[model samples]
Target: MRAARFRPGACLVLALVAVLAGGTQQASAETSPNLAIDAPPSAVVMTAPLDPSPGTLLTFSVAVTPGTNPTSTGLYVNCDLSWLGLGPSAPLFDDGTNGDPTAGDLTFTVQATIPSGTKPGTRLGDCGVFDAESRSASTSYSVNVVPAATDVGPSVTDTVPLSDATDVATDANVTITFSEAVDATGSWYALSCASSGDHTASVTGGPQSYLLDPGTDFAAGELCTVTVTA
Candidate 1:
């Protein structure tokens, strides 16, 4: 069958995919307050460091609203993020502990580790916000885990216009390859010739390789030197 073009029906699916890729998902259950004994949470909140890496800590919290359950007090919270190796049904607290900001505010919070060796990805899951009794409310949550940044400094692996060369092209651009990805912020290069004096070049390109495009060419038969600082 031929592929379908942009249709209204595809919008919902695309939007859902976009959310799953880089957004949070949440849903709340509807229950008649007067008929229930346990208060259901109106919202669940999960927080972590920006682009958290494996082994980082994550916090989960839920806000409970009073229902017709007049006797409900001392609310409890538990979350299942076992996909991250944290035990299922891990407890959260509202007693101004375990990262909770206030006690008896109906907002319970807890922290859990992402665990070492956890691959980077967006993980979707849920938590249970319960009253003092057996009744509980469910809320879905997600975490976006990113790969850890490498700590090893970059080293030059190779370069164009090889170390020392005879009769070289004056307008040639210098290219360099690095052992690892590099940050080019505040990077610069200087090219000078024995006969032509100091020269200037625009440093460009990226994490693994860079190119140096000189504004002026080297003088013929002149010894040239290049300096790079990144």
Candidate 2:
């Protein structure tokens, strides 16, 4: 996961390099970056939309600042990655070290691939940033994902039993086809029988058709009307 929030229209560039505890060397970074974790705001889950999919290749970064407290094992971190279509990284921690801001900040990189079966929506996870001595601080993260949208509306295509045709048979189901997926979410149309005799009508069938079947048969040698309205 990325430590910095992904801002829309902002360049998403990061640098992370895993390193074991060792003596300090000349830092590659020219200028140090701000602390990834702050007390007041308190670092939490990120807001950037990774837009992850199955087999998605992702890379991110994190920052660990130097303080008076330094543990032998370095820092410890906990975060939720299962919901992000991946698992946690190995030994989440960083050794306390300070590099001149003019010399650049020490940035660490994290990379992973999104697993299959991740759905399109908001995913939340936990993130814990522990101090060098194993003192733990935790936060939550959120990732919003959405699928590509194609703008297309549904329309009526064909209707059964041509209107105003004579000798229309009774005890038959009226099937209507649609141009696109209609009422896919839920019921968006109604079917009713409007004629001399009492009849019941309902919206039925798959996304395309609205099968209007009358509960009672049509009268003999009499005109009957059926209406389908959205």
Candidate 3:
């Protein structure tokens, strides 16, 4: 009791220690809950319209869910239409988090242009999505390419002047009009030049006009001949 009468400093030290202990307890009680993701680990779903038409644009939708809502996440989808062996394969599309949890579904769309002259059969390929962090939970879908009506024909309507004076451009391009859409793979089209040069060509068009690009250009004032085989 005699020591306490002169122990103001000791009392002050005890009060500070009690205040710090109370603050630490309150901070621990206010902590946030842990984040979580609940998507299927190895599942995916995709859908498209029935009886899709050739050369017509089609939309494909894909859905993906992640096993855990990662602090950092992204979605990627790759499609191969080469089974159709059309032109080039379809490009990949990305579907990131749409301000939603990582465990929810994401949708993606693409336009399908049936090859200019695709055969009547089923086109097959695969589609898949993966997370940057947890790739083990990736999902994939089998893509099917269905046959559509074929009404393309071969008929040349007109030709326009080309602008290759030097005639050195290997890929000189020109325009050709058509009476109707022609089958690009059909045996009714031929592109040639009169100069007897080592030149190759490809034809690309829709319902109205075809763009032709020669692997090599013709001599000055030399005429290039294009034949359509339908």
Judging by TM-score against the true structure, name the best candidate: 1
Candidate 2 regions exceeding 4 Å error are: 1-49, 66-73, 88-108, 148-230
In candidate 2, what are the lDDT values of residues 148-221, reduced to their tens digit? 44557666777787666677776766777878766643444444444546566555787776677767677556
* Model 1 C-alpha lDDT per residue in residues 21-71, reported as the tens digit of each score: 654433223332445554443456657566788877776677766444555
Count of clashing pairs, candidate 2 = 13
Clash totals in order: 0, 13, 7
Rank list by lDDT:
1, 3, 2
Most lDDT-accurate candidate: 1
Error of 3 at 3 (Å): 71
Model 1 residue runs over 4 Å out of place are 1-41, 69-71, 152-230
* Candidate 3: stretches off by over 4 Å: 1-45, 69-72, 84-91, 94-105, 137-147, 150-230
| Ten contiguous residues with the weakest lDDT in model 1 | 23-32
Compared with the true structure, what per-residue lDDT tens digits does model 3 show for residues 69-118? 44326655545556444333344443333222233345544555556575
Give all candidates' CA lDDT scores: 0.75, 0.52, 0.56
RMSD of 1: 23.2
The count of backbone overlaps in candidate 1 is 0
